[model samples]
Target: MSDLKKQATSMHKAAAGLRAVGHRTAKPLQEFKAQSHDLSALGALGSLLSATSEIREGMTTLTKLTRQLEEEWEAEAKLIGEVSDAFDLLDVLIAAKAQAEKG
Candidate 1:
């Protein structure tokens, strides 16, 4: 419920969404690369195929990084939630102690 937790949650959600998008694109990118390899028989078109292959490789790397980032974000969100709960508990304990002393 703290600001850090809220921001962490938002970041985690965004990372998850990006990771999903990356996953969705991976298969299509692989298919495109395979098809492009067949087009390599066209001589000049081979250059295009080569470029497409490079793009596919880049996409693969990006997808991997996205997945990693998603995991990190999720961990951060959990840590933030734990820290927030600890602070809330501390506040409650302090209030209780003050009340006990007054009574």
Candidate 2:
């Protein structure tokens, strides 16, 4: 009966020690949970920034394409003028050849 009584006393002391350890450990575990929440918020912010940057890059690309189209439009306008001048020169040549053959 005395041995059983000693065992109960020893178990009670062990439980008290474990409780102290758990109390101390709980604060850091709570701090880790808060830090995880902070990290998750940062991740969401990073995704938004990434999306904004991609939109900015897309705008820049569109501006470059518009400039290239403008340049091509100017080049096409000049070619049209050259073609019109060539047609006029051809008409003059045909008139001169017909006069030469008639004389």
Candidate 3:
């Protein structure tokens, strides 16, 4: 395989890892929100509830941004893979021409 293909493979793996991490993060964040919602039932914890709400909102935004980034990364990986394939084809053609010249 060409070096470009190797690089594209690495990039695709990294993007997949990022996506997995983001999914893992979402579960905990959702759990926190659920726990916070339960805590809000107690009037004495108004300040804490307010802070949790803010944190939840921020995390939600962050999750959205992370998802967008992951999508971009995946797209980039696909483009890189395509370029790598082109390079591989070019290499094969070059080799065939060189062999023909030798003949």
Tens digit per residue, CA lDDT, model 1, 1-103? 5454565566556545644664676686567546544644446664755665675566567656756765675676566556656656666676788899999
Give the number of colliding residue pairs in candidate 1. Answer: 0
Collision count of model 2? 0
Superposition error at 5 for model 1 (Å): 12
lDDT computed for candidate 2: 0.54
Clashes of each: 0, 0, 0
For model 3 the local lDDT of residue 12 reads: 58
> How do the predictions measure up, each by TM-score?
0.56, 0.46, 0.60
In candidate 1 the C-alpha lDDT for residue 25 amounts to: 63
> Candidate 2's error at 42, in angstroms?
19
Best by lDDT: 3
**Each candidate's lDDT (Cα)?**
0.61, 0.54, 0.63
- lDDT tens digits by residue: candidate 2, 9-65: 454455455445545655665565445334444456657666545544555565556
Ranking by TM-score: 3, 1, 2
Error of 3 at 37 (Å): 6.4
Candidate 3: segments with Cα more than 4 A from true spot: 1-49
On the 0 to 100 scale, the lDDT of residue 59 in model 3 is 60
Give the better candidate number (1 or 3) by TM-score: 3
What tens-digit string does per-residue lDDT give for candidate 3 at 5-80? Answer: 5665675566566546656766866675466445455455756556656655666676567667767766765675
RMSD list, candidates in order: 6.0, 41.9, 4.2
